[model samples]
Each structure stands twice: as structure tokens, then as C-alpha cells.
Target: MLALAALLPLAGASFAQQKIEQQMSYEQFKAAGLDRLSPEQLANLNDWLDGKLKVETAKAAETAKQSGGDEDRRGLFLATSREPVDGTITGNFTGFGKGRSFTLDNGQVWQQIDDVSLTGVKDANPKVKITPSVIGSAWYLSIEGFNARAKVQRVK
Candidate 1:
């Protein structure tokens, strides 16, 4: 149904009897070699037309969900390559020049994987932000007021 409608804008023709001839422009149909097609070949292609319609329907539904038509679809607007997670660290953050694990108050546990760390911040329950890598699930954590970002991964 949607594939037909998409072609409608290009063809400027109305549909009839599930036939592209009535829906597609004459030049476009000929360009696709439909004019040279045998009746059996055309019937075979038409038999698979419903698959195109299904793909188009799924695309439309995803577009609607991403556009906020469904309020319950949280994180739809965030990049799939990297997502943002923010919370308070469970303990006073000390510098970790090697590796360490951080447990957020929200129960998300992340472990540092890099060799960079910041010292001197002794505040309890400091705010933390974790941004995953732009290409994959590899994550980095940054404590509020700190300058260094450590490579991290979710442990829980």
C-alpha cells in the first residue's frame, strides 16, 4: 500500500486493481522494462508486491515512534552509537591511575578501563556522566568538576 502511495507522488496517477500501470507514470513503467515483461513475469513480480508494502509500513511506524508519536518510547531520540547515563557515584571519588569500578546510586555499575584519573576531589555522592563510544558500547565516565575522562564499561 505504501509503496504504491510513494510511487503515486512521482507518477501522479491513481491506482486501480493493484496494477502499476494505473498508478505509475507510463515513462517510469517503461524505464523499468515493465513494457517488455511477459504476463507471467509481471504476475510473478506482483506476487511479491506485498513484501515491499510490509517494509514500507515498518519504516513509517519507526519514523512515527522516533518523532515522538509514542511517548513511552524513551531513548528513541538518543544516538544508538552512544547513550548518556548520569547519576551520583556511590562513594568519595579518589584518583585511579590504573583501573577502578564505580557504582552509581541508580544501581548502574561501571568500571574504568583507561589509565587516566583525577585526584583531590573528596566530595561524597558526586555527580557522574557516562557517554558511550560513538562507534560501539565502549563508554567513558566524567565526574562533575573533573577534567579527565576515563574509558569505562558497564559491569551491571
Candidate 2:
């Protein structure tokens, strides 16, 4: 539900229920031949656009995640990108757990996606190094002086 909310271009917007009315300028609407459609025809057109938008949006999101990826790429990233990100964890790091998240000094936020936990430890601004897996899209976050590493996914 949150993802859908985030995906929508307009707040509280639902493509399925939306009509072409007021969605375009009067001149543009006539040019697009939407002015000639009957009420039922207009509804059918809206339904068609709704289905098309949902399918295309999902495809684009998937492509972006697989290439530029789950993290905010700032600009772009190649699938062969193997860059290691090293930065200090923002604020206090109270150890790791599944779904735990850490923001870095570089403005990237990553959350643990695995069941691995590193508990009973606390540190302010712990150093973090995240590197992509050699064989897959997975990224592992490693804290300085810690042997255990947690699988992480970029959220921002």
C-alpha cells in the first residue's frame, strides 16, 4: 500500500477511477479525440489507460532496481558496478538485526534484509563498508572490527 502511495504521481490518485476530464487542456482533449467519446466509452478508455500504466510502471521499477538498483543511484549505475561504499554510520549504531537500517554519511540508507544479528554492542558513528556481492546483486554491510556481516538492501 505504501509502495503504491509512493508510486502515484498525484496524492490519493487512483488510475482506475480517474477520467480524462480536466486531465488535459480543452484544445489538447479535442486534439486527442477524447471529446467525442461517450460516457461509457470514456470509462473504457480510462480502464485501458489504468491497466497500461500499472503494467508499465511495474516494469520500469523492476528494470531500475535490477540495473541502477534498490539504492538511489544519484545518476546511474551499470549492472557491473562493483563499487564499495565506505562511510560512517549516521548517529548511534545499536548493532544489527533483520530489517534494521543504517544511514551513512554519504546520504545512502541501507536496511538489513537477512536474519543475521549482531547484538549486545553499541557505538556512535560506527564505520561501515558496503560492497556488492561478486556473483549477484546482493550487498553486504560490514562494520569495522566486526567479523560478522549483514546482507543489506538499499532503500534510498
* Count of residue pairs whose backbone atoms collide, per candidate: 0, 0
Quote the lDDT for 73 in model 1: 22
Could you estimate the TM-score for every candidate? Answer: 0.47, 0.51
For candidate 2, write residues 55-141 as lDDT tens digits.
654554566556655334521233223467889999998888999989999888898999998899989999989976432256799
RMSD of 1: 17.0
Worst 10 residues of 1 by lDDT: 8-17
Model 1 misplaced stretches (Cα beyond 4 Å): 1-81
lDDT, residue 116, candidate 2: 92
Clashes of 1: 0
Q: Give lDDT per model, in order.
A: 0.59, 0.67
